[model samples]
Target chain A: MRYFFKTIHLIDYKNIVPKTVIGLFIILILLIPVFTRNVVTLSTLIMTGIWAVAAMGFTLVLRTGQFSLGQSAFMALGGYASAILTAQMGLPFWPSFLVSGLVSGLIALLVGMVVLRVGGIYFSIITLALGEIVRIIALQWEPLTRGSRGIIASAPPPIILGGHELVNFNASLAPYFYFMICLVAVTGLVFWRIGESRLGRTFAGTALNPVLAEHQGIYLMKYRVIAFTVAGVFTGYAGALYTHFLQVITPMVFGLWQSIQIMIMSIVGGIGSLVGGPIVGSILLYNLGEYLSRLDTPGLQSFLFGSVVVIVVMFLPQGAGLVNLWERFWNKVVWREEEYEPDEPED
Target chain B: MPPAEILIEGLTQSCIYMTMAFGMVLVFSILGILNWTHGQLFMLGAFIVFYSTTAAGIPFPIGILLAGLVMAGIGILIKKFIIDRIKGELYIGVATLALIFALEGAASLLFTSDDRGLAIILPGVLNLGVVAISYQKMAVIIFTLIVMTAMYFVLNHTKVGLAIRAVAQQPVAASLYGISTERLSLIVMGIGCALAAMAGAIMAPLYPINPFIGRTPMIMALLAIVIGGLGSLTGAIVGGLILGFLHSVIAYYISYLSEVVLFGLIILILLVRPQGLFGASAK
Candidate 1:
């Protein structure tokens, strides 16, 4: 709950900004289906929940000055872990979800132990390579992943929790929608707490000045490894949820560009800013991509993304995503007008 | 012919990697920013030749020269207009990545995204013993060596090269000596881009050419430079050769696992020596 409220603080509530503004935005996301009475469209929001989860998980390490370009790899691993184990072996749903996430975490922990020792551009390049390696393995590991053709009909778990048997997947999308909402809520809470915690402070210090942090007696390498390993866990969980949502695991989803895309989303939104990344980054990027494809020029839209990045990085060093509009306005108008002369203070 | 053939083939492959890697290393050593668009520039060079010979009705020799000059002009212009304005190494990197995407977009929009084959030159085999190395293979090796020797002569002997080297080695000291460090950086990039374009043109005949084809080889070239040595020209050449031979041999043998093998080697090298094989310890 505090995590939820903390994100509220992340919002700009300072200058008598109407509470209705924020309230209306939240209501719009929640109450859209009610107004339209179309349950089908809620599906898009469900996937957005998964994107939120993955971004939150990724933000943990990215804040530590370590960019892991292996999100798609971890994601694919988590998705396949659950989909295969449950679909093929007939494992129960609850156990599969937990096991799938743990497997991704375990793999991440192992990779992190080895990979996180390297830093900066080298770290980014290596992670990207590792991602491709994993994707290639997934492509070749036909027995488990079904190769390039991908696995089909991997619907939501058939097993009922506490003996409450579930129906077909389409009929149960409503439940999955709320299920996603819960996942996002839980993820947001955990991520916010971690961001505000001692660990987060350590990460920030380590990122800014590792040598200084080390002199302060902090174990730099250990904390970085921890951050990366922990991030893997959440990304894995997000993947597991995403698998159920898509009900399919494909090699195409784990592409290197896709991994880069996720990275771009986070950075474009804003690093070190909570929830802004997923909202401003993932939702918008994903929506824009879809809108472009619908508008009959996917290539043109992608070109615009590249153009936008060039413009944004050139003009606004601070990302345009999730920026403080009010602060900008106040600085320009109010602060200028309120400047009093020093000579007037003679009394 | 048997073993000599394999050796010459390997040499040709190594020559390609070495040339491209040298270009990358030169830019990085001078600017400290990895030009992510380098691969595109390389690809652009190939397209320049392609467009020149096919569309503009230029002879092979003239087309190659024209393509090199065209690509270099673009590189120099990019450095002056966009990259020179950038503040820091990090921003330069981000900006270069943006350029890669934008160039890819422009290329795709202008040309088909499909692969385009270049006209074959020196297309015959030379039987050495058991190995029969092709004429094109020998030509590639000879051309690369020529480029390398040319670059070496210029860098070691010429006044401009000396100035560029001076600035790269120590910018503050060079500035005290009244050199424009910014102009020197641009010159370094321009030359690097020109060399990269030449590599692209030379290799076009041997491989598939496409707009986005620059990325993989570019990344590999960067890795090669890192593994060889970040700043040393000698390291760049040696590293490129090693990566090229390994990539070709591994791809031929393991097929799909080539990238996996390449990345695995990169990780291993970084873990062992992040400074690279030829790279000097950072100051």
Candidate 2:
């Protein structure tokens, strides 16, 4: 079995076929609304896409070895900023979205400067506290956020093409679904590019060994802050998208639970594998939670989610989604051939 | 808003925080991982006490004892099975977090999400001139003192305590010197969990017990330990007292916005002293 797997591994499919396959998969996803106009399915897919974006952001920070339990704070900032800009200030959706990402990123940069200095568990605790503080602020700032009652009837995203209003997101799910798909694809592509860049290598180096990276002339603090800010931007974008889609903004929506859910998604998807891991994890876990909840079990969803996490961490440290266990299985059962050797060793 | 009332309330609150911080510090010192389920363990303790006393017809003191013992067993099991297998700070953190979710889910399933309370173990109030203090609050403070003293004694005088301390200080060295580090870990985890359970059981009568009630106290405990210095027992106690006082005094003055003020203070403190008020500089 091992010999067969080695032979299979030797035959590397290093071509554009894999890229084409992914492109085709994305195309199919874009066409889902056309095949079946089920509002529920569309809503779930939209949420999965949004969460996938946030999870990718989380993965970026994880790349720098910083566990931020305050991603929700950035999400809240983006959602609120965009909601306020669009609904109260009468700004266009495009500008509001851009400003939202910028706002979140800037805040993250500032916060990262201070908290990143206190690295490790201290960083995690501080971020957790920061998240809580943001939630509290949202709850207490009644004039701005309307407190726990939240901002109702928030402005929906307007689809505009070449200076003409094409569609209002509130009218139907198709435009919003396509918009989220495009957003997710763009976000994924951006992350993939980053992963293949020198900056991405720096992030990996920092995460793997900060001391070594620092010795090699990489400023750990700078890279850490950059990763955090980038993550904030992505999460903020997702939050803004979420607010516009739901047409409601509440402090409760961006609480610790949401942050934990995003973390769980990232972990389940395989935090090590930046793009596909988190996206797949989010879609599967979100759907699983929703499905379990519908079974009339009060806490079954959380219970099962927790169990999966525990089992994965304990048995499959690389993460269940990230590990290519199926390939090994296929090699063991189906491809039971001897290892190919162009030049056999004398020994 | 009398100073006396605030002081009394603060001290009472400190008792719970101290227990929590103490347990958290113990586990953290030995295992080097923050048990995210610490709060959930506290919640489980409260539920255990509630059920044992209210449903099973056990006496309140017996119920508390039972809760502690049960939680200690759970702690051992978690250590043996889940925590022991997980490696690295990040993975352990995630695993413990998963434990929190699972424990909370299980508690919710067993007890339902409704708020519950135990009958006051010590009823009536003592009218001391201008300040009246309830016997229940007095019991809470007294119980906390007793636990702390006992723990101090065990840690200082007992052979097991010496082994625990030795292992905590230098696990490899202690293991070479015939101390079983693995066994010590299990003991420490059990003791830590038992302490959390005790805190929960004792506080059940004072506050409405729910599956989620542990979260706030847990956060407060986390803050207390952070302020007190992560691995220092003395720091945990002092930090707990400071936080307890701040909580009572701030809540009295600021009402619901006290949480914001507390977290903000933590941020400021971290900025000023990243090592915490009593913690050693990071190694």
The candidate that wins on lDDT is: 2
After superposition, candidate 1 runs with Cα above 4 Å error = A1-24, A36-49, A158-169, A172-177, A295-298, A318-347, B1-9, B85-89
Error of 1 at A264 (Å): 1.5
Q: Which candidate should be chosen as best, given DockQ against the real structure? A: 2
Q: Give the TM-score of candidate 2.
A: 0.92
Q: Is the docking of candidate 1 incorrect, acceptable, medium or high quality?
A: acceptable
Let me know the DockQ for model 1: 0.41
TM-score per model (chain B): 0.93, 0.97
Clashing pairs in 1: B1-B129, B1-B130, B1-B131, B2-B130, B2-B131, B228-B278, B229-B279
**What tens-digit string does per-residue lDDT give for candidate 2 at B220-266?**
89999988888989999999999999888998888988988988888
Per-model TM-score versus the true fold: 0.88, 0.92
The lDDT per prediction is 0.72, 0.82
Q: How would you encode candidate 1's per-residue C-alpha lDDT over A1-347 as one tens digit per residue?
A: 01111111233333434578778886776665556535546767777667767776666776676767678778888887888888877887778888887898888888888877767666777777778888888898888778897765366655457778764456646667667777777777776777667877777667766777789999877888888777777777778888878777787887666676676566556554555556466776666555565655424655666676666556644323344333344555766544321121110
- Quantify how close model 1 is to the true structure by its C-alpha RMSD in Å: 5.5
lDDT of 2 by residue, A289-321 (tens): 777778666766677778877887787533234
